[model samples]
Target: MDDPVSAQRASSVRRSLASIVLGFELIVVFLATLVIFGLSDLPAWVTLGGGALLCLIMVGTLGLLRYNWAYGVGWAVQVVMVATGFLNPAMFFVGALFAGMWTYCMITGSRIDRQNK
Candidate 1:
């Protein structure tokens, strides 16, 4: 009595739409990472090093930005930089300054999102 073929076509269309949505999300993530990287005064080597560490953290922190542990990991990174004062105290302080601001923004954004929900 009903057309199953048209239903299958509709399902396919939904799948395509979902794929497009996910692709857009990936693009947004890359742009956000770029902005985050751009906002810091980190040196080339420090940026490269931080980039690598961020990649690792992203693997674990994906879809968990609202979690306290995400902020904890960020703070830990800042603390590690602070503790490396022997290497270059200025570098550490500069990085921690940026890191602290970034963490503050992230926390505030999460709070806003929670409140808006």
Candidate 2:
């Protein structure tokens, strides 16, 4: 049997780690958008609009982190971030780097949560 307080604490810790990753990713995605706008010949609206949309999604996801399904959405966001490589090849590396970070946080957080439980 598990203690409710410990379980809740573990959950809080995991959520905090996940939130940190997403928050940092939000900044990187925003900067990547600027880079894409400057380096690519795509129309201003396309770049700006797409960037704005992604940013909005990130912000929204941040609020949804308490839900398990939100983590799946986070993974989808990671895929989209990597897809941005089509607009700027550099984003492939950057996106992968962030994905690695996200993976690390998820794995580490889970381990910590389990240990706490």
TM-score, every prediction: 0.40, 0.88
Pairs of residues clashing in candidate 1: none
Per-residue lDDT of 40-108 in model 1, one digit per residue for the tens?
A: 566656755654555555445433433446546555544554554444445456555555655555556
lDDT of 2 by residue, 1-117 (tens): 999865695467668888999999999988988888998999999998999999999999899887888888888899998899988888899889888888888888888878876
Instruction: Give the poorly placed runs of model 2, Cα more than 4 Å off.
Output: 1-11
Q: Which consecutive 10 residues in model 2 have the weakest lDDT in total? A: 5-14
Determine the C-alpha RMSD for candidate 1 after optimal superposition of all C-alphas.
Answer: 11.9
- Candidate 1 Cα errors over 4 Å, as ranges: 1-68
Could you tell me the lDDT of residue 83 within candidate 2? Answer: 91
Candidate RMSDs in Å, in order, are 11.9, 3.4
lDDT of 1: 0.48
